[model samples]
Target: MAPRILLCGDVMGCLNQLFKRVSSVNKSAGPFDALFCVGQFFPESSDQLDEFMDYIEGRAQVPLPTYFIGDYGFGAPKVLLTASKEPANCGFKMDGLKVCENLYWLKGSGKFSLLGLSIAYLSGRQSSDVQQYGVYSQDDVDALRAVAEEPGIVDLFLTNEWPSGVTNRANASDVPAGLSDSMGSDSTVAELVGEIRPRYHISGTKGIYYAREPYSNIEAVHVTRFIGLASVGNKDKQKFIHAISPTPASTMSSTEIATKTTNTTLSPYTFVEKGSSPKDTTKRSSDSVSDSQYWRYDVSQKRQRHGAGDGDKLCFKFLSSGSCPRGQKCNFRHDFDAREQYIRGVCFDFLNKGKCERGPDCSFKHSLQHEGENYADRRPRSENSSSKRSKECWFCLSSPNVELHLITSIGENYYCALAKGPVVEDHVLLIPVEHLPNTLSPSAEHEVELSKFQNSLRMYYKSQGKQVIFFEWVSKRSSHANLQVVPIPSSKAALVEKIFSLAAEKLGFKFVAKKFDSDSDGRKFLRAQFDGNSSLFYVELPGSTILLHQIEDNEKFPSQFGREVVSGLLNIADKADWRNCKYSKVEETKMVEDFKSRFQEFDPNC
Candidate 1:
């Protein structure tokens, strides 16, 4: 059974009243293990000073295993000074502070287990002043971020400040329209909460109780619930206290739970190695054919038909593949500089004469090399090693080092391939033929082909009594784009949009949704609909229910965020880790052949 915890916000040194209230509530509340108090635990006025000092001086005793965050109030410095002298209160431990017999103070930031629940906290308020009781420092944020980076689940997260933009998420009568971001709200807090993706996010000091819906974070498989509490002892009786028992970590995916091992090893999925690697572009390296080149869940292959590219277009094979079949008859540019310029996405005219008339929307790399910077010396691994990015980029079609036999179908600008590790037999990836940074950057022609591919899959899935879903995580930096095409049971298809919106709202935000009048006519909607701020993009329930999220600078965006959602929706979350779903190459090949035969009628390219 999960432990029941009582959460209160901003006691304001009203310990006598706070405990009295806690006791009254606990009478029927039944076996509450701990009471966590946020906001100002110190007395705001002199009237409560004498009574607050009584507990510190041993004249009175705390009733339960009470934990408080606000440590700066009238009589706090003097009283806490004495407690600091005790052996138990020594050092900078985030936990284990002996404020009184049953009282504990969560100083600074740290994580600890309480009643089998993992609790993380950043105590104190947002302030630059070092001496302020509620003042949270950069050091605290830094320490908390380190904890959040670990692979696991935090059952409960406590903060003195609310996450920024939380109030704008839900429509509540108490939350005034256009209420300025709360003074007690911190964007850093929101970023960390997004990174940690805790089950429950609790905060106080704003004096309002807002229980938000569970939101799916970018990096984490689970959704987080944000709850803000009102100031204790406030006359309006605004809800100052909340209670909840967390679901056991065992119930969650292993990828979502943190273990107690000392191993701090990094996985290739999250880590990017620096420096150049030895490779020969003279010919396709034997390493490319080896399975060692593949990262977790990497999948790519091409079904290039004859006479596809324009006669004037550049041939990537002649430039990087070390050989060309057409030889003198090849109509493509074979110059190294021309190919490199193309790879960098520089406008061809700009490369030729150093000028481009199309401006920013030209969809080309537009940057000048600064003087004194050695372009050759600082060339990225992708440039130095011709196949490096393609070899590793699962969505790069030019890479011969892809899951070759997995290609299902090929369209004009897009193609379909089996997911490297699929939960469902029909799971597939619809990827762009070009190395566009993300889904949001697709050009008009690319969008048209993509829509056709989606429509074909949607129609086919409906005929099969299933629903198709398309989702992708759009990165701010360069990454080959692909949309996850998953087919869910028809019964649950109707619930996908509502379930996602409800989930997004839990993290104190909402997913802005739009529906196109028709699958083919959606030309201008996305060119401006998704601007610079947007990071996540998806198409649910076929070509409808388009959703996007604007990412923050500090947000932790997961590479496999969309797949994690599908895993949960299918109720096989344990297999959410792609590693668990891996099959032998032979098995994968056979599976591909089976899917190809079955997908013939619905294959748009076919």
Candidate 2:
């Protein structure tokens, strides 16, 4: 059954009147599962402190199961601080604190399942000074964004302040009197609501009632209804409480849920440029990274170049940022594959300008491998040498050059080794025990063990507040396969896809992106894409986004492509080449020991 819920505006310590109204409604409307309060649940004046303490001190009872945000005001600091210190309220508890029996304080920002309904909320107003308890931080805003990316619809979103531009596209008469154009709303909340697309968005801070017309959300099947209520017992007697009994989205069929009303209007949020469509603007804006070290691309025109094009000549504009103004209509070809084939065995800048400026820093092949002492000659023997035998392969456990101290863990068919020139701390390599050329052809037993190690690393890194990315380059050469595992800051997780896409554009190639449920599924998909015979590169990003590319037999693809992209994401492009990031034997051994000690609990082999 769908849950019956009651939503209230700011109480401001008017508990007697609020519950009197709630009790009258409960008796008539009878049983509501829960009452959710927005805006200031606590009072702003000391005069109402006695009445507020009645409920907090258990002298008076909360009429129903109540959950509330807006946890700031007169008496809130003392009350909430006391609740936070309780051991029962520790570590991300969704049900929140059992504040004086039936009342619950939904502190901070989070999403939780309430009687099958997905309820997400942000407590407190936006402020530059996050040290104050009355305001939300960037971390809280970002956490909700991560929640927005999760599957399923948000039944309700509660915020303390109004989303800026909430009045747009609404009937003028519907807006309450004396409301300003801005309505003192927060743009961050606006951006969040646009992303979350909750079925109902409720807020209360201005002490005025405004029930907006249902508006359509970008890329969503259902529409969102926004309602801003006035404070409880306001002088104007504006509506302060709303009743809703929405069926859980999980129970509704897609077609039924997609059904829209005739009153639906365009979203009030104008997030992009004037001429661009909402979907196009969303894609580009969502992929953008603010880091100064990383470059942004013109993703708007990227799709136009994906269609059929003529000639093998490279499009210079497309080569720089993955988009061409002329697109397919351009005389020159805009294909990354064609550019890759053309640039093989030659430096791209050198080919275009008749001279290369990067000198030793350039990663591209200035000359073929057969040419004496090229860039390939300076790489590690394990990665670049032609030794095909396990006895001679530098990565092999039996090989004399294999660093025994770097071996951290060993499974039935795979072993973990610290990267010789680590791109980031805790960066490790997963290698097959057998003399295997690539991971795709590994047996089922080997594949399972590989997944265990991947999961183990993921858990260990997550505990350190970091996210891990895995990438591998498989070629027709005799060298063994080693999947590079690099740890990145959790905050930069959103930038991984954008940085890699930008890097791919600069290098004149596009990676085929797909979602997979597991590492096994990812490998199977890659094998199918290449028909099990081609050299290919793939990156398993922070989440479900897997980027794949096939290497042509004659193509001189950079073996360090994965590392280069990750280094760029980390804003340490100097360490893209392993040779430049070498450590002394003592330092390397210390790193190994530190990693092993920290990783012991998560190791499946242990």
Candidate 3:
């Protein structure tokens, strides 16, 4: 039997009411392991302090082994200070410290095992000011990240504030009654949840109970269920406590651990670019998506046309778009800074406060290599060597322009989504989460996740009585990689190789066929076929046969070669051009939801 635990929401210093309800629940659901609380553990006013003090001072007994966060109410500082002075509460404790009999305070952020369940927690809401008793700091977040990197899955994660955008794909009816999707939600908490990938993320402080449908996590083999409890005692009588008896992940088999419910949705914490308008993201016109594909080439051409002068700098508008309205008449330079482009813009937090709380984790540029000598000296030289995607790139997950509604699944290094202006139904693209030019050769860990996605998709399509073909065109223009996965009727599976070869012959090129048992071996063969910098295209068929082609310099290859061949094999040549297959945003959203629902069973991360 698993450990039975009771989880509760905000107590708000109502010790008597909370205890009364706990005692009642304990009588009915007798012999539970422990009780955990989140949000406003202390009272807001001094009048209620006496009741809170009674429990802490042992005048009134706590009913069960109760632990709590949200240590920031009226009497929190004095009580915590007194506890810290005790010998048992001394140094760097991750687990709770006993303040009184049956009562414990979980301070800061840490992870510990109790009753065979691995639990991780962040004790307070995010704060910008220096860390004190009630607020959590950057150190706490970093500390948890280190713990999250350790071995097995975390069974439960406790936090005070709700993660930002927690209701992104949730139904309006399923959301809490009075709470908005993003109100009072902290982005830092969201990031931590994404990284930690806990099985159950319990939070409070919103005063409305919401038991969200289980959500899939990026790069993890398990799903996370978020439950936000309401206040302990409220007029609406909303549920403030929940009971669960979960078997620890360590004891469960791999198959049992990966089980997912039918309603599992994609992770809600999609990287959203700040300050982007709704219109920018929802524009799914074929022309816009196509133009955005070669944005790097466009930037390069603009730089060539308007050379950077001694007194001029790059035009931000021109750099973002291929063309600026001013054209040749602009006063500023039209060239962009190649080094600064990848980091997006300067870090506003660093600029305003001489220091960024995110530090190395920030996605924005801190300072120019030649500018800010003091800051430059402090930064590691290798920090700038690593590449990151700009928000302007259409495929980058952090970009404001990304079509969030189309995304189905996200992993650590890659994500899967329906293609914009898809060639056919169930047309999916497996894209690198980072900004990368090609997928000819990926790292070992990346290859493992990529293979899992491929196998999952293969099984999914197989169940539909169809065969899947994967293809990618490594462009010389250095654009983002999108490995196209298309499904064809089983009857037409034999014709796939024939059609691709015919298309290649028509384009005055021939493919070299290679056999490999696994994706890793195929990648090794590809790396040996051509240098990493060369442009190439490849197709992986059902029988482990890969058709590889290395495009020579200035080779005239059609951009739609793979889609055209697959379209012909599926007898949908008219839909070969993605523009012809465009769907309305409403229809696209329905398509994504449908794919997510059907694919949940085969989702490896689920």
RMSD of each candidate relative to the true structure: 19.8, 17.8, 17.4
lDDT of 1 at 43: 86
lDDT of every model, 2 decimals: 0.64, 0.74, 0.73
Worst 10 residues of 2 by lDDT: 289-298
> lDDT tens string, model 1, 1-606?
878899999888877888888888789776788899888788888998888878876798787898878677777777666776788666556664888888888877778767757789987767667555556665456456556644346788998888765554232234544445647777667656755667788988777777765554443445566788889878878899888887555346444443322322221111112111212112222222211121111122221443433333444333322223334444444444443443444444444335555454233454532223222223333554434445444566676546668889887788899998887868899887766666556777887788778888887777788887777766444356677888999877777777667556544456777777764534355456567444555555554546666654334344455665667677776455565578999999999998888778988898
TM-score of each: 0.44, 0.53, 0.49
lDDT (Cα, tens digit) per residue for candidate 2, span 114-165: 8868789999998876666667765466457656655567889999999877
Whose lDDT is higher: candidate 1's or candidate 2's?
Answer: 2
lDDT of 1: 0.64
Residues 1-606, candidate 3: write the lDDT tens digits.
899999999999999999898888888986788999999899989999999899998789998888899989898889988987799987667779788999888888888778878889998887766445668865566556555544467899999999877776432137645577466688778767876899999999988889988877755558999999999888899899899899987566545767998888777754333223322323222222221122222343555675643124434334433233344544434432332342345543343334666675343566744454332123333544323334556788877768999999998988999999887789899998987777766677887888889999999999999888999988544457899999878888888788888778756788998878876677667667756656788998877778999876445455677886776666654466565577999999999999999999999878
Q: What is the lDDT of residue 78 in candidate 2?
A: 91
Query: Whose TM-score is greatest here?
Result: 2
Candidate 2 lDDT score at position 189: 87
